[model samples]
Target: MGTADAFHSSRTHHAAQGAAISELVDRKFAGRTFGGSIRRRLQVRSHDGPSTDAGRKARQAILLVPEHEGEASSIMCGWLDASRRVAELRPFSSVRTSHKTRFGSEIDLPEAEYEAATEALRVYLSLQAFEITFEVPVEPSGRLPRPRRLSSAAEVPASAPEARASESWGLIVLAALVGFSVCYLLVLLGVIG
Candidate 1:
């Protein structure tokens, strides 16, 4: 393959590997005394304004923890420690932490710094027996929203009694059909003739 093709292929491979590792970590530590695994992708943009191409970077990381091991406050503290370590390693970026009652806590850092911190966090978690993995993006500024519980389609609103009634009717129809089929079969076999 050509150089460009090879590069693209390698990038795709790397991304796939990262996703697979994330899935494995999630499966291995999702339950059983382990809090779920979290996969995060963050964007680092120029703090100056919205439409500025001055400096931007992107980073991604995954972390796993025991279920309820650390509450919000403790997680924030750990994030602060991780950010500080990242800053120590790479002094090129500024890192800030914010805590809001509604939004929880967040650590905003430069892309490079974020990547470094994520690596540091991964290592630290490993030592602490928590599984984690991370990857740095070639192009910066790609943000992924934190996962949250979403209402399933199966969920019905309290006001949607009509829909519920329809579902019940369908179930009744299904039961009637099954009953009819069983009776017909019995008659055909001379068992209930």
Candidate 2:
């Protein structure tokens, strides 16, 4: 095969492998809760701004959390790819926490829960011929907080319902002010009371 043809074939194979891995991981842990203190977190997010903006990328991440209230322990894995022009993903829950800290408190997951997730992923990866294994420490050494970042004005869609609603209200207020001003000027000139 030509060099270019070989490269294309390899890329396609890798993409298919990645998709299979993602699907398997999500099915195993997407919504299951453990000991009422943990839940599987599989979040896929993307950003496709104006075509002129070449820095935009799509994101996919999976996190396993053992706690959500007070202190917490978690695991996270993610990757980025070129934009496919997809809709953005929003959080499944909108509930706010009482803590006002700048960062989350990280702690070790109970040995049982930690081992369960690690072993499951390791076995699946091997079965897929992906010679990879988790190298986690004896203790949970990473803090996997929910990712957050600010978006530029250009990144926010003007067609969003919230944005359109606020804009419509602003125009109505401006029209009201103009109408009131005209009435006041007419009264001053004795054109009308």
Candidate 3:
């Protein structure tokens, strides 16, 4: 195919994917408020706490958003502690945090909640390329049972140790190839055997 045809095909594929993702997100988060900008995406929820640990204080706000910019694709959902010092995530992504710490503020999620949150994150990440700005009404009452330190379904970051090691190996092979080429050229010119 021609260059123009290939470009047009690629563009069309991306557009179709975007449309499908938007539809899926609309259906998935039918009744949740959508917040965040083009660069970031999040769903904001608020409701009464289920257990005493949550306390019968003011309505607690929960945010389902990406863990961090470095792991933009990795998402977690939870509210903050009373002190607001740490983000208490339930159904937390196992994608190691920026600090490389094994543990942090996380709570275990119930099976039902885990499924719901996992579906939500999947829907969110699907439409990540486009700007999502639709807001669904938050439930006035009833708790959405959810998780804490569960493994994340997000993709591993490119900078993971395994990925870095593979890159290093590639660089070494490339350097050896370049060195062999230089030696071969010198031999051809009778400068070295």
Candidate 4:
């Protein structure tokens, strides 16, 4: 085979092996993938846009742009092709093309995988937060608390009956036992403690 053919063959092999971050593209997968179909991420995302003048105002985080300028078109095609191949191999799902994108790429899966992907994404995003804290806002909005008068027991209708305070009798009994124990201990000390 010619050198170009050999290169393409090697790229194909690499794409198959590397899977989600398909080696053919030489661009890191920008995530939000993995309903087991990886094609949809080949986006010129909002970040990758200066697709218009206003987009240029924002400093964007560009990811998944291929390594070399000359190979951009081929790499994009190869990346997409590889994604479709990977999508076809998904055990529990198949590629669904119904949902479209301006980027002209979509790799959806069966409904089952689509459901599971939400949880997978949740876990994925959760782990992405290395540090978490309830820090205050940089500039606090000084706002008054809105007073909401809670509904009285008398106002509750027969439908969806309000929970009776008497339902906590077991807890009250437990508290009484604890209180009795404390009283008994104090009395035993002979100081009416």
Candidate 5:
């Protein structure tokens, strides 16, 4: 290979231990760089919540890239309805992924969507470049939160259960918003007690 070309080389290394990883990328990529391989995986999923979760017509393809070596990244999907409006995704690091199916507007993965997903993966796998931050505060129950600036995910040392409790604040806030919306609707209809 004199000139640059995609997929310069590929190799898989199996450890002597148990099955920890399925595949590893160790070769010249896009023919532009050599060495410093990034761990990656391609996954297809029907629904995120559970087996009972709907959207049978929906399907998601996730390209998992460890932001940091050996660290797991979150899965995300962008679903487009008949109106061309993409379903809102949260805690989604990349807006490139999506859900597609025959019933929806998109029958299969489109060129642009694939390109976006690859681009996002490229950035995350980049040996160098880019930064993002988001932070939120925790308040005691039955008390209003104080104003504060937020930053991206950070390394917080907490117990296992506490860590989960903290990460779940997003759901708590969402539920509160839903409750307020319902209450407002009831008030507008003069159905409030």
Candidate 6:
């Protein structure tokens, strides 16, 4: 195959393999992209053995591509799409937060929560042509919840009959090819005459 064709075929094969594995795990996979800029911050707090001490907070902002004007909507859409995927991957709880914007929207989330959500959004946005800034709080126990099973049907495996039929068809094709090759060899050797 040509280079492009080979690349396409390889991509398809990889996707199929991924789908097969995801199916076993009862998960669905989706991809997205963003185009603009992103900024993130993380905060952490340590409670001192029930003492009334306020938690620690850290703020960070990242500015990428200072010249991509008039692309905010595209960037927002990509971020939302990626956020949805993160929601799917960790289906246990909603990571919805309010953002505070001087003239736009307000997003408010805890440091760990925002980190998980923004990580997914960042991946999707990176697929597009935009800049990104990510600030994540370092929490040793912070992790996205495991993806839940969407339905009981998704948990079930294929039926035995279907699997048997597939195997039988494969064997039949192999036997037919082998038989045809043996006959062709005999004909070439004049043994069948």
> Per-prediction TM-score, please?
0.22, 0.34, 0.23, 0.20, 0.19, 0.20
List per-candidate RMSD values in Å.
21.0, 17.9, 18.1, 20.7, 21.4, 18.4
Q: Note the residue pairs that clash in candidate 5.
A: 133-151, 133-152, 134-151, 134-152, 135-151
By TM-score, the candidates rank as 2, 3, 1, 6, 4, 5
Clash number for every model?
6, 0, 10, 0, 5, 9
Error of 1 at 24 (Å): 2.0
Model 3: residues with Cα > 4 Å off, grouped in runs: 1-118, 126-178, 181-193
Give the C-alpha miss distance for residue 47 in model 2, angstroms: 11
Clashing pairs in 2: none
Q: In model 4, which residue pairs have backbone atoms overlapping below 3 Å?
A: none
Candidate 3 vs candidate 5: the lDDT winner is: 3
Superposed model 6: Cα runs more than 4 Å off: 12-70, 73-149, 156-193
TM-score of 6: 0.20
Top candidate (lDDT): 2
Clash pairs, candidate 3, are 90-147, 91-147, 91-148, 94-152, 107-147, 107-148, 108-147, 108-148, 109-147, 109-148
Give candidate 4's TM-score.
0.20
Predicted candidate 1 versus true structure: per-residue lDDT over 53-128, tens digit per residue: 2111111233322234344222221211121112112221212222222354443223444455455445544554
**Model 4 segments more than 4 A misplaced:** 1-46, 49-108, 130-193
Model 2 Cα lDDT, one tens digit per residue, 1-193: 9975564454443243334455665666666554334443443222222221332222334455443544453444323222221122212111111111223443233445544554555565446543332222222233544444423432445346578899999999999999999999999999996
Superposed by TM-score, candidate 5 places the C-alpha of residue 43 at a distance from the truth, in angstroms, of 1.2
Q: What is the lDDT of candidate 5?
A: 0.33
How high is the lDDT of residue 157 in model 5? 23
Best by TM-score: 2
